[model samples]
Target: MKLKVTGQNRGFSILVLVAACLLLLSACSSGGNGSNGAATSSQQSVANDATSGGSANEGAQSSEPVDIIWWHAMGGEMGRAVDDLVEQFNSSQEGVRVEAVFQGSYDELLNKMKASFGSNAVPAMVQMNEVSSRYMIDSGEIEPVQTFIDQEGYDLDKLEPNITGYYTFDGQLYAMPFNTSNPLLYYNKDMFAAAGLDPESPPQTFEEVYEAAKTLTKDSQTGIAIAISPWFTEQLFANQGALLVNNGNGREAPATESLLASEAGMKIMTWWKQMIDEKVALNLGRKTADTKKAFVAGQVGMIIDSTAGLKGIVDSVGNQFEVGTGFLPRPADGAPGGVVVGGGSLYILKDATAEQQQAAWEFMKFLAEPEQQAYWHIQTGYFPVTPLAYELDSVQQNMAEFPQFQTAVDQLHATTLNPATQGAVMGVFADARESVANAIEQVLTGAMEPEEALQKAAEEIQAQLERYNMTNG
Candidate 1:
């Protein structure tokens, strides 16, 4: 394994950074309509063993209530839900008092954390995007939730395997998975019917999607509104059973290079370029918000977006059209792949007191409970990380009313676990996503051919990989 998260000592140097990438920024998550993850377990030692027997690790039993600061970056309805959860946790417990602080966006929060590293200003727990897994692992500022899991005897089985799989590394889980989401192919059912296509069936293959888009396109109305985002590209690569990086998606070992110029990448790039060239799809640049508005206004027939955006989009569309959700389109003749889990996870920071760490872990467990998970799933469009949440009345009722929200969960359940689906992890994911989006934009704008664009993107990402590894190596 490339990393280790073990030992009973509270705060040990798990990783040594050759250089600081503290100024490096990243976010691909919920509220942002996010990014899931995995990590390893090997012990240097277990000198100060903590909790046992499947209970909260109440960190040396403090005399005074432990005060812990939690930094999060969820805004609007999702932000309210987080505040509610935090309040519930705080009032429900007597030993720990949590002050939940809103930390702007993920990028801003990350930058703050980096800037505050090794300082007293860092919070006890932070909500981080899935893409930050590799960076977090290398930072040495986190206490692997695996430590708590080992001490508490937590049953991993009750949780969704796909989600756990993403966070589990070398038999150890890193961060506690929270607020999970995945991309979906959202189509206007009414538009489908008007176009003489079955409203119940959205296109399942790239070729089929193209044909459907072509048929749906008429004058100013395009079949789909596409935003040049790397999330969709990553989903497409997985959908076609391919990897975006080497070294088992930077698992098994740290990623040394990018695979953006591979056949899977080319196929997606070619398809994207072809759609624009044929005028069946509208390129709305890098902002998904723009494409989402176009779709909500019924200007576009279909779109691919995060499940986290489901409730807002549906509510916005209102009676204009019946919204339908479908699994992400794949290569018609290629091997079927799956979508990667997007969104953020809660991490226990090392700068915090042991009491604070224990409190944070307890809070994590509280959020993962079926009751809380169900409430969260409904409050935000993000699906529960645990399967038990699905059996609750809340989830069932919500699904019945807004059936479009069920597609992402259904799509996730049907996914076959593999490296492709587990997705990529890198310290420079923010820059990488931009590179991919820029490449697609260049192709669409005729600034460069698809082949040239992908090659340049690949090289740029490869450079990022080398820099990160060299700095953090």
Candidate 2:
């Protein structure tokens, strides 16, 4: 039942052209709204009405189906899965028809959404990355999911609290949890056995990981391989219960500066430098693909990555080496703080009509159903946002086939829903993340001292925060 509007070959180009037209139109219409301008009068009114207990679908039941547009960044197999779900939802309901549109990557989709803010071409629903929560909330182009939940008195008890916690700010959920994942340690079981290490007992702490890496390192195979990404740095800080920024990791109030110059951050960077210098860990630069390939090729004993990579890793390594998964290592000196969820969520745009919003909400709710969630989890290695989805027969079968997936589920259950694990919410989080990654690269490549690199990155983030707060506050 799903209609394909554009062919795969032309989809990206057409989307870019459409986005350009929208941006031009929006710019010509609005004098100086800029990209992060305040909500227009219409948007404000919509927000007010939604927050004041007004139903999105206020009109009486009509025979005409409400068509809603959904812009998502999913591509490849994930995109196909999304289309399948959209088809199912459209066929299952008579009152609503959801049109799913591919809008490139998360950054591209966000750019298009921002450009459409000044015009009326915004989608009824969009999938936004988790780190963009603050910017999305500030843009005022979104109606908080909590508003809809409160109006309908919907039951969200089935959803994972830790997954929901990331999108929750000011005691309210800003977006509906959709695709969620956490980092996990992937090791080569064959390499572990050859190194005289038990594949069943993976390292649980940073010190243990380092010791294991030393033992696993050999002539051709390095102990571990990790990409130079800020994500790993963020995870390490979270594991140590350390703040990445001030103001309770930007949950209590707008963060004014970065806190990456702290002892925990320094410790992680120092350890990373030592690992690379000692040849215990391969410096895979900034490309995750490189690290993944190295690990699958058995050139590295272990690697840390999101649980979402499990299926891909298994398929790539295929029959060559037994791949084992474990929870990401914690800090040696601190209490286990748990891993933060890294995925996108569904947001309803304010520019859409009441009926469109209602239809979008229905689609969101349908997608969150246990069956759909289980199917999504199975198709795309993303964690099921709802606990009930795990009980599904298909999900159980998948777990039986891939016991390594259970580690992710157990890790999620063990994670504490605290501020540290909730992750930092900053308007310029993407830039900040890049700055941290650059700092790590500098340290690993011996271009700069760890302290100097961290200090420079922290300063850069502080400036970005100041600039963002000036316009957003």
Candidate 3:
């Protein structure tokens, strides 16, 4: 389901920096945002990591070179890509050096961050996810980036809100989007054609999805498979006007508030239950590979997954089936919401020296450049965070070669500021989402009626929200 965003007034003109062309610079800083020593220290740590890099630079500053450490979750080629970028930056600069370290997956990074904080051994810079922003910001462990942007004299307007929002708390911005991605509908053209469905025209609406699923379901096949997590299902419910939380901030607003138990939510769960009962959809395990495998093996007609999964799908499917990309589907007449974004951001850790913070800001602005952004877009299936990145020659050239990349960009134009799309603002969001997922499982497995299951989930969420509010809000 497409989570819609209500389009705000476009008063700020988007500066299109065409790479292989020109670059622009502007200055800004954190305005009207509260600050704490812990948060500043966190931000400094992030800055320190980027500035110190891999090793101590052999320079003439303070008679010795300083070093900063970075802890990140990126691995394999992607991890290498990050290290290479750091290497390039370090080689290009002469002051402080930056070091890149690969820790593990998302969960591991979180654990490490918590442990380091307890030990007062936090790294200089940390790679953080969107959902974790609230925790870091509230913990007073992260520093706002707007100050860094201002000091660096970089154009704030050059970055997009979708990219900026990941790091924003209250009225201030903390982190910067490093690798953000949106979910897209992936289908096997061969399967569609074999099922007598139009390979070119995908199901754009939930009704169409149902029809297509029925037509695509086989004796040994599941027509559609979406992750059992709220990540995927939230999009569907968001598209249908069911909010997972009260505020439009994606569980980042008030812990005291709750909204998941609305009538819209009930309707959404009912539909899911009906889909499972009638065998039109398959409730696959949340294993990422399993979803892709089902699609590649032709066991499922449609898979709603990340655009980042495109390469895996292409590789797995090979020439066995035709692969097609489409936007996330929505209901026919609800407030059209776009999809929730997923990805990580770069946060400056507090406690870094001024020089390191300056150096880190330089690297961030460097990454924001159109050329760097285009390179990232090509290497990964993620959409470029800036509008100008789309206008870059590299991006344009890439779209010419591979058209599927356009779907993600086109969704940006369709974005609206709906509660569903903007996301929830609550404490313990991760835990609350797990509860929601458990409720979904119960419905999918026929352990409970969808309405009852979701209502129960809402009540539980409300209870949690109240507890969190008492403590955090």
Candidate 4:
């Protein structure tokens, strides 16, 4: 539900934000041009009231449609595909018309939302990363999604439980998870074959990963590479019985404190040190893209990265060599916990009129529909948030042919809502992630032992959490 691991890509593009702002400002200033300006609340109100008062049997009588504005980050072919689906929805419903807006990256979209909050001109609906859900909910600027679910009579159980857990805070649901994914072990099948390993059977455990890496390691090359962050370390720690925070509901319970400095954590770090010493594992900078590219180019034999990297691998290795996907390794005791999902969800803005909310709800439901969710999974390589989608014939067919997609689905269903794996949730997640990333870089650079680096990271993170809890709580 949230992808805020240390070094995870933050919606960090500044230019996109600036350009969006300028475009919006220009649209606002040029009132007569109906191209890009947001709809006025008065306009939306009139439409909603008209639709509500006039339609118990709108199917019997034709009426003007409700136009809902949705701003999203999906673009390129994916954007066009979403737009096509919206068009289909428009044609299917006599009461609603959804306009899909392509905003930039998650970070850029977040900044735009902040700006809109100040101007009282936010979009009716926006897709936000799971990590930022708490802040949006705490601001009281967004509606609790449970209200809509209850009002609309939607079944809560229809969605994945782990996905629901991501958007819930203080026992209230605030977002509808649109996409969810997790890291998988992607390996060069060609390299595995050359190293006398079975390409069909990838690394099943960390011990095997080490041995396979030893075989795959070459000049100016390492056998395996990990992007240092919660993506690798947290899941690995979970496999080894380590918990970074207090055991309970993970970030859900503020009473529980962090345990990143605990014995289990120390053991995890010590093992990382050994891997480094053995020269089987190297720390590439904390970019998922860079590490993924290193693996695709055969610089590294294996990489533990998000399953979302599937597209990149397919693109880079198109007929170049064989690519293999497998579940993340377990320790001797098996996976410490279920693999936590990492992705984003959609939240409704509070200021939107009830009619707009209704319209937005339709779009949200559309996204969650079995067909659309399957399409999203097929396009983005993220897991379908709903199980029914996976049951669709098309989804099953795709899985049968692709095979790689099943790795994420299998791990996702196997995941549990444990604190050790569900991920840390505190107000200063962004800052805390930065602290962890810096500590990781320090350790990988040989400036500090993993234990010392992690200890410093724990102190810094705890301090940030204390300050955030004090202010936000």
Which is better, 2 or 3, measured by lDDT? 2
Please give the lDDT score at residue 345 for candidate 1. 92
lDDT per residue, candidate 4, 270-361, as tens digits?
65666777898877777787888888778988888888768768777788778888887876554467666677888888667666776787
Residue-wise C-alpha lDDT for candidate 1, range 342-444, written one tens digit per residue: 9999899877665567767877888999999999999999989889999988799999999997788889999998999998888899999989888888989
Question: Over the stretch 295-377, how does candidate 3's per-residue lDDT look in tens digits?
Answer: 88888989888877666577677788778888888766655677666778887776555545455566666677777778777
Sort every candidate by lDDT, greatest first.
2, 1, 4, 3
- For all predictions, the C-alpha RMSD in Å is 13.8, 12.3, 16.3, 14.7
lDDT of each: 0.83, 0.86, 0.70, 0.73
- Give candidate 2's TM-score: 0.87
Residue 387, candidate 1: C-alpha displacement in angstroms: 0.8
At residue 472, give the lDDT of candidate 1. Answer: 88
Question: What value of lDDT does candidate 1 attain over all alpha carbons?
Answer: 0.83
- Give the higher-TM-score candidate: 1 or 4: 1
> Candidate 3 deviates by what RMSD?
16.3
Q: Highest lDDT: which candidate?
A: 2
RMSD of candidate 4 to the true fold? 14.7
For model 4, what is the alpha-carbon lDDT of residue 45? 44
For model 4, give the 10-residue run with minimal summed lDDT: 53-62
Write model 2 residue lDDT over 369-407, tens digit each, in one string: 899999999999999999999988999999998899999
Pairs clashing in candidate 4? 11-107, 238-336, 239-336, 338-415
